[model samples]
Target: MIELDNVSKTYGSTRALDSIDLTILPLRTTVLLGPSGCGKSTLIRLIIGLIKPDEGSVYVEGELLTPNNIFALRKRMGYVIQDGALFPHLTARENVSLIAKHIGWNRDRIQNRIVELCGLTKFPVDALNRYPAQISGGQRQRVSLMRALMLDPDILLLDEPLGALDPLIRFELQTDLKEIFKTLGKTVLMVTHDKGEAGFFEDTIVLLRDGCIIQQGTLSDLVKKPADPFVTRFINAQRSPLESIQNKADSKVF
Candidate 1:
């Protein structure tokens, strides 16, 4: 369980995050959804200990999450940022094996891990031998994901992992990722501006606005009872039933 108690952050006069409290459930996907600059990235940064809160505390599994403890905690957490942050010079296999080598794993062990990750993410065996410049965007993203999962961290944080892909490829990866999560049962926290993406992939949705949580609940809960007009519009815009209604309204009557 990840807990944030009255977390707040400020940069000079501008407040990036207000006094926010949240408890993330384990072994499930929880999505943070909102428009850009609404503090979703800020929340993710704080969770990963990239930045510290000006006030309050963060805890993982009953232990206080401080800079001193963050290094230890990171070993048990995986973070995937937007875009495939791969090394252009390194081949896919080398990229995936990099982390294992850092932790003093032997050559045989690293090779085994690369093989396992390649199988898990469905990357072509030959593709592993090629550099990032040689693969498609989707493949690069998959390699990034495999690298992130190299250690099998309990907590996985994804920031717009599919945001850079084309619609069809994005949908394919989204489905693949969902299935992987179901099989692994890891705790996942993802930030996305796409409402449909959130609804399709997450078990819980957290809506944010102006550095605050506007609402949070299951998709069914929010769909049946939106917290306010913004949420209603957001849901309506992405949900299929609402799209069908919009299509009907725009249909030609001859």
Candidate 2:
């Protein structure tokens, strides 16, 4: 239920997004996948009102996002940036309840919401007192998700949510995140650079390069019917270490 019409953003000499038009459909996961400097995060910032576009407009739920309505509209969505961005000085429970407290939620209401989110995100109740540094990377990510979902927003925006975790932890979070998405059935707009991760979570993948969309479709569509040569190369370039070892083994065989 988000629409970007001819959106453009520039920073001095560089253009982060150029005349981009995209629509993030409701009740499905739409992922922005691309290499570094491809404007994925910029797109998210534009929609979240963190940064305004130089040209064009951003609409959420059929209303234009203006300065006056930005804060109120923002409350309709939950955002989780990379690295969790948790407050180091606060405990996990405090961190998750920060926004709710700021919005004047009563103690009982806040406590109930936090408890419900803990179960939804699979975060342990015993670890609520722990600080970010005291927990594992996966637990930290879970805390971040709990905080994001505390408000029960209509849309969820995750910017490279698992980028900092180890492979095993990342895989675990991926599975949990996918299931959470299905359970919540909210509009999801996630940004990621990993093709495999995008393919795993994306109902529609939007690949970008040089501040423009290169292709937008399913993983199978991108693989079998590439819109450009770059798409083919981009899809094939992310081979695993096992594939690399297999290549070396084949070269030495008869």
Candidate 3:
């Protein structure tokens, strides 16, 4: 579990986060939904200790997350960035086991963990020796996910993990991700600009705008009981093909 208390961060004149107060539920997924520059990614970085908040504090499992304890607390959480961020020179196996190797995990242990992760992520064993360029975008993301889970982390942080894939691949991965999350039952924090993606996850939704939280609730709550005018506007902004047609029909326009 993670908590942000009265947190604020700024870059030059831009306020990345403004007095955020949140508590991440244990063994549940929480998606940060918003447009770009809405501070969704910044919030993730703050939770992972990639950057320190200019004001207030971050806590993990009831313990304060400070410089002294961040590294330790961070290890308990796994992070997968956009595009997977895999190393081109390393094979998928090497990449997934990189952290384990660095931490002096014995070969048997490392291999065992890698094998387990491959199965968990549904990655093929035959592809283990392939480099990032040798795999599909979805496979690369799977590799990234495997690497994140190598340590068996208690929490997972995903920043637009499926954004780069094609629609079909993205949908497939979405289903797989949902199943994996349910199977593991770890605390999960994900970021996405896509309302559909947020709804597909069927988890807690935290909608943000202009570096501040606009609303936090289930998708149905947001649809029927918007906390602000902006929330309704944001929700309406991302429309499916059916919704688009309905909107045009409702207006009697071509």
Every model's Cα RMSD, please? 2.1, 1.0, 1.7
Kindly list the per-residue Cα lDDT of model 2 for residues 1-254, writing each as its tens digit.
Answer: 99999999999988999999999999999999999998999999999999999999999999999999999999889999889999999999999999899999999999999889888889999999999999988999899998888888999999999999999999999999999999999999999999999999989999999899999999999999999999999999898999999999999994
Clash number by candidate, in order:
0, 0, 0
Worst lDDT 10-window in candidate 1: 234-243
lDDT (tens digit, per residue) of candidate 1 on 44-114: 88988999999989898778988789988988888888887998899988888887788899998888877
Q: Least lDDT summed over 10 consecutive residues: which range in candidate 2?
A: 113-122
Candidate 3 lDDT over 163-235, as tens digits, reads 9999999999999999999999999999999999999895799999998988899999999999999889999
**lDDT score of model 2?**
0.94
lDDT of each: 0.88, 0.94, 0.93
What does candidate 2 score on TM?
0.98
Candidate 3 lDDT score relative to the true structure: 0.93
From the highest lDDT down, the ranking of the candidates is 2, 3, 1
lDDT of 3 at 139: 98
Which has the higher lDDT value, candidate number 2 or candidate number 3? 2
